[model samples]
Target: MQKIFLVLLFFIASSAVFAFQSIESDPIAALLRTKLELENPTEKLEVSGRVLESDVLVHRFYADRDFEEVWSRNGILLELAYEMRFEIRQAKFDGLVPEDYHLALIDAYFQTFEANKAAKKPNEAGELVALELLLTDAFFKLAEDLELGKVDPAKLNGDWEIARKTSRTSYLDLLNEAIAKGEVRQNLESLYPKFTIYKKGREVLRVMDERAKADTLDWKAVKLDKAIKVGESHAAIPVLRERLNYWGYAKSQSVLDPKLYDSTMFLGVKEFQLRNGMEPDGVIGKNTAIGLNASPALLMEKAAVNLERLRWLPDTVQNLELILVNIANYQLDYVDKLDTLFSARVIVGKLYHESPIFTAQMSYIVFSPYWNIPPSIARKEIIPAVRRNPSYLSQKNMDVVTFSGKQVDPASINWSAKSFPYMIRQKPGGSNSLGLVKFMFPNNHNVYIHDTPSRSLFSREDRALSHGCIRLENPALFAQTLLKADPSWTAEKIDQAMHQNKEQIVSLPRKIPVVLLYLTFWADSKGQAHFRQDIYDRDAEVLAALKQ
Candidate 1:
């Protein structure tokens, strides 16, 4: 009996030792314990008191729990944190770790996830994944801060000298290495917290990816000696063939004939230019080459930055039939039931006179809307025009009115007087500055979309030409589309009202939502983000806000 008892005791001790070893060996389990240790005493892991009672937070928790149930076998909060840490470590390898900006970054990610959930449609799983990646990046950044000996419980709010001291060259080298290895692309949101140019880089990367997939010709294997001459241009046939392939024009077994270079290759270049939203001409210009040779990593970064911009948008895209103006793209899209019904190129407010981002409803469409000359315009444009050409107001049918509805003659009003309390109204006419039609969505900014007599400006790629209002390319067609939503109205009715050149306000039968957004990057139907220029320099402002 004593011998049996000793053997049983030994077996029990061995089993206990094995179990302890296994727990210590498991990386995930170890990570969970470590995170719990860090968070539990710090109280940072607790849900914010302010948020806990809010509708937004409640909805978010439910959505996150649902997502966890679906993807992680109902993983506990600690499990989620551990997975986040792993993701952060992965992001750190790509130089995208979000050091020193932990709480704010995490909050941003959660807020975005919550907003996406509250949107009441199919959750953008892509956006949710991006947020998770962002959280991971934050963890790695925090880890990096600790490694650099910059982690201070009290000094967390202040500037970290270590991050500031890091050389730009080293940072860029690390990023480039990661890009080359395809460890991370520019469009990954993890990079946005670190780099300002990430947004621009993403746009370039997307274009590069599209160009690569489209182009089938391999230039690297071609011999430079086998050059062919066509028309007035003389160059390597293989190089030309590769360029064609890169632009998605070249097919397998397709050999470029020397004589067809001017016709085929030149035409192909034009098509490429057109597709990229550039000026189309049958020429392999410097701009075209630069655009074509742009790296994919750079473009991806731009997309990532743009995705950050999307977070600034309201959680719920209110109003069914709405007009959305993408400022960076200099374009307006009319969406009904979340479907794009009409689109037009628009000349938005210039950088100095930037159109503010807000949402409103199109209550009325004015046929021959009166152009109320703003105070700034009155002080600068009208006063200068009168000084140069006194009949300028008359030629444009603009009448100067006193505050009491009394008409003041433009010739009589003192040009030098600073105390002029006068309102300028451009009369309804063909030459009216507001043009034939104006889509009105009254907001604090006092801005709206309208037609312009200056059609020549629409041809330019950079259409930030307006003072504050949006100038649409095809206003008549746009009006027709909007009006057609009501069965009683026809395109003929809209045309008649415009041709009459009378000021007629047509209230929308159903109010259409207008979202004047400032998104620089957004994914299209293909899940590819289309990037636009940061025309208003809003990226830095947004980035600053995010950092805070």
Candidate 2:
């Protein structure tokens, strides 16, 4: 009896699978069934030499329509095809490849369809059906890629949390609704990121593209052996002025000598340095020369890669009052309502120990926080220093503690042992690793923003000097900004708490989101293009995947 029931269930499922592909009195439906059932469906479904990328979506789309032609009625293509084809061609402006959506094949088929209509010939076998399937698949692909990003950031270990713009609408239903209302273009446009940065980047790319097409990209190069200080004379000064002018920075030609770095040129050079993430000193140094010599092609490539990164972010990042730290820029910004409330320099992790890109919420602030040295650091750095200096622990105000965190005598342990089992924690004081306060947003990586005793590191232009944590330049001011809503936690009270020499936790009234990103290229609100070196060397990998 059991065997008979199992056989009945299997037959029911088999009949359900075959229900959609049954050939009725329709040539388009029959052709679609034949092509989709071929042994190699990918090769069989090829439309004018372009194999379909979304075969599964095509199957579902047609099955829902009972395999009827979507782009045509009575073997004549509809006006929606024209609008969709135009959108496919314009996909290039969104940092996407137009040809990836079968643009060339669609063009070929479209021209032949028009020619056939003019000559009074009938639609060719499977021609309209192919267009129907391709159009639907293209629409779905664009919607998904724009809404959820084309690249899988998780595959690259990028902790990107992308949320859909229309969480309540299904893609299939959205596509159907769009076609029914003739709102195809509006539907596609709504999926792109709504950030102002994204819009500015698109405009920048448009200008760059037009320049490339016209072959009119004005760029210049500079070569110098040593730093050219203000009022110095060098043959490359004229080239430097031209380079600055190319990016909207104008420096008047020196009346005395065109090669002279005059006062006017010095200010322009300082502006260039500031824009390119360098110290704004009026010196034509090596790094500034690299920036001056950057070609249009390099900027375009970096812009494309950073645009892809922007697609991976959640749109709400711009909608909230948040703390944003761009690792590549070595800076932190406290922003609300799309305006930066405060900005400060930051020290991030070194190249060997890269600061990860992730998001968490700041829930509390710890005044006079103890520095819990990580196990890796203890094994690699502290133990070696202790081995070299007998009183290293005492000098640094650190203690040898058990896993449970009870203090132990440092001198009682064997200094030369390779397999040490202990944790090193610094006491809360002026010389503590964490200076006076630490903002908490507890994550598995043990990373947080805090004040550091090594305050001099903040003055350096390249502040990637921490051990997988972010060190703030002004923690006191940051605290004041965060606790401004509560009048009790004034600047003086916050200061006294920092120097109390006791660990005290202050819970925030509400959790504010903090996002750490690594965008190497972006445009400021004033339309100035800012560029930074790929400090962690992540551009090549992301760009390769993006183009692929």
Candidate 3:
């Protein structure tokens, strides 16, 4: 009986000690310690509309600091917290929704704390702790999203092979340094992509956002039902002229016919076409009409989508010397540190066989390359033509070759068979399918940039005529530019090799990087945003994933 009474007395004394410690404990730290223990995970870690992107890091952060509250001291909010709030509100200019980082909740908590402080209510402590957690959460989340991205590229597109930013230090370290140095906003801004185009895009987005907030309508596009040309009357001309004038295109007065598509409108149309990556033919066709109908909302979406895509690339891409191909625009640019050395027209793959987006290294230039026909092209095209015309092989200068690459006589083989056991090889010559030269880049897709015998296709604005390879407009000039750095391969030597009618390979001294992409929205060096058609229907997928 005495032992039982002593155990009860010890339990009572322990409960009293625990209650005393709880009364003196830090509520914010205590709440964080308790909440971090529970697990509630989904596809994204979110709670009450607040996206905790770095939930694991948030946990580790508090643990590393021994669950000490950084945003407040003795229930008084720190100035750093307000600075963080200002940055969060400014994120709208960065194409990010501030509410996702607990902006609304934090504002409400601040208001409640003010009311409680004025009324001398005890619940002010709870509001203070809530505000503290939210500010810490917001800082951590912004850091993660700025350094990396909100959505994973691979999750949206399977062929997204662009490398993400690499860093030696963890985000927790960045957070610690940011708080210790009292530079939360600067730390977040420092993670933005340093590319010139990205900066331009951000500025454009900010202006658009400001206009949206101000309820100021810049201009509304007018869609035409039929193709309109100069010297023709159209009902949509008045609004179209007004829109063009708003965009800084010159205007000319012609009181004779306000409804007519006049020369003044023609020049404005050409300028619009040139800026939007159109053919600038001064004819309002189906594509031009689509460009004209780019509502402010759609333009904003384009800006946001392209910005997200740019974030996937390494920011150092702005400084690197490389060959960039915009498949959507059907253009290739050889740029050195964001300056275009030269640009050329290119014909990429058709809609059915879209040119893949990836990066590789151009290793060598093959002058007068022999066409090793893929089995699909041979079976579908060459065999059918050969069976119809007995002299097809001779006309194309192609030889039926055995498995060992030895030429075999076509006369000895049976032509009526469904399957052809031998491969067809086109000899290197002027009439060769691969005109003059081909740039080689080893990849799993077996795609490369090459010159084409069908040069007339390059003149077409929509140059998605090739099977899968990229066909350059002038291969000889491209070769000269690529080999200009090497003392052994001069312009004269490159010209000689291209027309020599003999296959020769020249390995580059160092491999140059090649990036093939399909950005429909890009900003020029002059700070004008350019938009193009989504030829591959890829933007919708990315935009949808972004909203998610």
Candidate 4:
């Protein structure tokens, strides 16, 4: 009975596609015209919430065609419907839940249509209309999610004001174009970022979900009272080996020296450490233990959340020179045409002063840049420090200036005043907060990538010690790379400009796009996934929103 039903669905589905290809007089338009003229418009669509507005779009679309069935005509689904169904089933490849796009409802309608055909009974006219309406709704819903991510950026984080503007293309017109070109799947797929990392994330999530269901994954914390060094003997060595093997870090079992931390186990632990955003020291420490203990499901959830964040990026990222800064990873990648030219370590903002996730165009580079103290820092730190020590400004290569650019004597100002409304500008020198050079991308955040005198911080595994700005380890090298398009700015010229004690601005020949994103989980080109600590704890909020 099951085999018969399956064969029946395939036969009807195939017939629908064949009929669509054979029709020359726009069968959908004729059916829609006949349905619209009927006294009863009984197929009231079942859509609510944000999607309710699509009803007007759907009605206008059919009315424009004189009430023709778009996806089907006379109870026969079209090739467009089959293509849409296939795309909907593969929505996970785009970091979307298939269920969210009404896949089950669509399958149910097709199954019912198949049963009616097999029984030699006509499906209710209202039911046929409902099928078309729901399928149309699914297309729009899927398109919306693909174009603009599931959550609004502004709602999630007010500082995330860098999302691309909504496309002005009418959903109905897009559907019509897709149907005409027989490219429903292509249309939907074109709306997302063309990065392979997203596909890897989906694949990882699938494996994680399977592991979760089988209960084969273990996240039990492995704690040793004493640190285990290479070639050291420990009671927990066997358990550590088991855990490492389960996570695919270790390939072979060592029974001869099972209780000893040998070279093989040491290398596996280092690789695991690297994947977890920790310094790969090969010594099992507290942080390594914590990383080993992270639940696979939790890591999978992070990957899923980050995949959605990728969807929030502007579509321009597909074909542009992109400077992507992964805040969680504390690394920046200079990419053009999907090829990563180089990567550098970076220092992001501290937890209390979180770095924002946004996109902007890098227009220019400022050499020997002055750091204008932010009002909050001036009020909280500079003023307090100056009050305690009268020579604080001169000692730190800083000067007091009025809002109107008039220089003021730091010693002359009243230190005990309640309000300090003056600007504290740091001089362009080695001790300046902005180091020797800064990459300027004008935005409301007042944040830019710059060099730092505190170069020692870059060596640390966790380099999140900034005042809401990124500090590049090699700012001069980055500046030279950015000016590669300009023949005037040679490597020697860039170095000379950086060493100068005077401020100078050099605009780029073409603006480079920069994206500051906080992705806790990232997959490299080779499909090796890495998970970072949610320094800002954004994963939980994003996961909660996805649930809603």
Candidate 5:
């Protein structure tokens, strides 16, 4: 009888201890249970008006926590709230606006709670659960923008097929994973671009912003009727010197004789011209004037726009052998592991025929290639030319060919037709439009990097003259570089093939990836910002989207 009484006493004492422990250690759990019914998570989310992209994810998220507080526990999640606040504030560095994510409201709510943690009423704390839901919603929205970009390039430009992350974890899952691993910063950083270029651009922005704060450059347009070249003095020299100093091109602003366009000033002007995508001839012409007139704020806006454009690129560019074309800059760079193996000035499509931005695998290099003139070009250009002169095709080394490889007499076909059912192919020769070699990357756009007979056009500062194809400055050099993998094709052999005066197809042993991109503003490895003309007027559209 005494043993049974002792066992009952011990059971009662154990139960009391367990209850006290639950009440003391988990006050938030006890309070939430009394204040809110978490089992009906659908209704809870409905009341908050927070709908996730995936309903299943929402249901699973709430089910995991039984609709309990995932973000906050005692008053508010002070540490996490502060972390989010910091990220929001740092959004500008990433070319993002914090106001877009309700940054002010989140920070205000967190601050109020942090200051008065003990003053939170039970009902008020329960009501603040909505803050938890709102924050989670905001966080996921932020992540999506940072990871996948806010604007869809495909929607803006029809030809842009930028690969995006289709599969991603739920916001709840991401939060839990971060918390479990105790790595908030790492998780947030993962959402941004993996490219080092993006980071370098941010650093440049930071430095430029600091400089702007110290003294905002108030550069006025310095117009001159005549061109200002080296070894010649001009009245605009003082203004030009001031402008160069503001742009960090000139060494000092405290010159006693700023009016003199000395050799030192000439060097600075040349460097400025080069960085601004103009010919570094130490000549202050119309193009150089435009660069000097662009204020620091305008330059920053350009950089920000290009940074957002960078976000549209793939997170992982696994293509080791890359042919990257910067259309805005009118340059092509063959890069491998952050090293530029080969670079050349390229003539891209004109404003009307803007080059389509995309990526593809180059399969082959054709030697002394025949130029198959596009149907649109033939209808718009060839037909008209033939009408004016019947000998146009023969003079230009062009011939009419049926779709099935049958040669058709140019005189036999009516030149007055609105469209031609046949293709016009240029015969392989020095007079042929496709010079000597062409890089073929099979794409629907029918755009190829090829040699051109108009080599003098490459000397122009602005080389946007092609219809839609990329015209390489040195095709033989490009061919030699690409065929280096094949032991059978030597540099001498490549040169011989190009000068063979007959069409010959040479397939690449291994495929090389090619990316045609547009970047009006970017930073070099040294964090120096480079600006280029928006030849196709693409920067304004992206800037408008960024503002939106």
Candidate 6:
């Protein structure tokens, strides 16, 4: 009897140790701890000793000890762990959230603790697994968003890390190398479902099947000799011919003349150049030659890259009339429902002041808006002007105002002092930097689209001239387009309002979505992939992150 009792006691002790070990080294607990550390490195949870008890033991303790202390402790710990897991999972899904959301999440963590304390059983498995799935879904979503439906399988498979590291090659070069060599071309559609390309200006490059490859001619084999014809009916002889023929005017065309340039061919070249957004000069310059030599494959790649950029934008097409600034094209297209009512040449922000890609609702249109010069502009332009001429403010209809709204005479303030707190406002007039109209969309960037007095700058094809806000070439027409959306208003009415020279606020009946997107490649209605220069070097950074 004594031996049997000792053996029973040993068994009980071993079982207790095993139970304690299981609770202490639980996988769920470990996961919770890891997530907690990731989220709040500075904060430490004060876990009670009673919270370390196993779930079964805690239940027994609750039943035996009148549903107090130990049971409450276990429930609190479980709730805390669950909430931490959820937060980690949410972060994984969002990739990166705004700082305000983080604060909300912290409040949610505490709320979970309180709710779990009252519940009889915690949703332990469901919460943990759900969080993991949410994180996975978010990651996949980010990938889809970045791809913009034109993901190249081979490019995706290419050593993204290596490509990113090689600063010598541009993003396009890296993509080309990967697609050509990585055997990834076959998987492009699977990776990016949203992308489509064009071939021969007539056929859409839908599928990269074996039959499609067989049918398609290599772009290199399609010689310009057969494609372009010289005729009297051509737009301009010398300009047209130069663009049509590929023989880089490095050497005179033997078919035309040894000494004299072919005038007929030049006109065709000029016509082609004008249509293709190139300088319409009849002479085949370096840019024209580069454009001519660019293969169909290269153009397709550009289209894919641009499609990826579009994915970052919101899917909603708001009904209101708005301005769309295409940074790559250095142009703004005022799209009004079914038609592009007004097109304008725009000077976008420079490299340092790159026009950010974001969406905003146009709240109001300010006619003859006063230009409250930004601090950067004041320091860069205004201060210099005042130093050169003390009467600069008076000449430009600008007044320097103190914090109390009292106007400080320019002569009294030291122009060289950086500590001065003053506001400079340009009075509303034709000469005012904001010109006739300014579209306001309040954002953190404090940037807006407006008309400018510098109309000559619009003539330049590569117009990255502004500090940050877009300067419209034809603000009057753009304003008319917006007003015309409501049948009640007429163009004559808008013109009359502008001519009044008073500050006018026009509100859209419905808010329109304005997407200032960055796209380096896109297809025209004819299905030809139009490639533009990468004004902002985003592709390289994105490609690098993708590879990693």
Off by over 4 Å in 4: 1-44, 47-53, 70-83, 111-122, 177-183, 199-215, 220-240, 254-262, 285-296, 404-406, 485-493
In order, what lDDT does every prediction score?
A: 0.57, 0.82, 0.79, 0.79, 0.76, 0.53
* lDDT of residue 94 for candidate 4: 51
Q: Pick the candidate with the highest TM-score.
A: 3
Note the residue pairs that clash in candidate 2.
none
lDDT tens per residue, model 2, 1-548: 99999999999998866764455567888788776666375353565556676677777776787777667887888888899899887776667777778788788889999999999999886788778778887888877777766777777754434332343336777787777887788888777777778768867777777756754545645667999998889988877787777766664453678888888878888888887899998788888888888777767778878877887788778778999999999999999888888899999989888999888899999998889899899998999999899889899988888999788898899978878788899999999998999999987788999999898888887788988799999999999999999999998999999997679999999999999999998877777677898888888777778678
Per-residue lDDT for 1-548 in model 1, tens only?
Answer: 99999999999999879755754664333333333334444233423221111222222332332322211221212344444434444332222323433445555655554575477443343434333434433433333332222222223332111112221123223333443453433223332323233334434444555665665544343333332333434444446546666546554345455524555566666666665555675555544554455444444444444544443333345335678887777889997765778998998988788876667778889997778888888887888888789888888788889878788877788888877778988888778887898999887778899998999998886788888799998898998888786876677787788866458999887888787766665545444434456677655543443334
True lDDT of residue 123, candidate 4: 69
Query: Where does candidate 1 stray beyond 4 Å?
Result: 1-262, 283-290, 537-548
Return the TM-score for each candidate structure.
0.59, 0.86, 0.88, 0.82, 0.85, 0.56
lDDT tens string, model 5, 366-437?
898888998888888988988999989889988889999899987788778766789999988787788888
lDDT score for candidate 2 against the true structure: 0.82
Better candidate by lDDT, 2 or 5: 2
lDDT of 3 by residue, 1-548 (tens): 99999999999999878754653487767766666655574444444456566677777888777577788777777788878889898776566667768888988877776686688874555566556667877887776666677667777653567776665447787778888998887788778877778778878877766655654444555666788999999887776776666556647465588888888789989999888877889998778777766656677788888887887787556688899998988999998866788799999988887898888999998998888888889888998898899899999989889889888899888888877899898888888888889999888788999998898888776888888899999888788888778777777887788886668998988888999987888787687888889888888888787676
**RMSD list, candidates in order:** 15.4, 5.2, 5.5, 9.4, 5.7, 17.5
After superposition, the stretches of candidate 6 with alpha carbons farther than 4 Å from their true spots are: 1-261, 283-286, 318-322, 336-338, 403-405, 485-493, 499-502, 540-548
Clashes of each: 23, 0, 0, 3, 0, 26
Rank list by TM-score: 3, 2, 5, 4, 1, 6
Per-residue lDDT of 170-190 in model 6, one digit per residue for the tens?
A: 222322333345322222223
Weakest lDDT window of 10 consecutive positions for candidate 4: 44-53
Off by over 4 Å in 5: 1-63, 68-72, 114-127, 157-159, 163-171, 219-226, 231-239, 253-262, 316-319
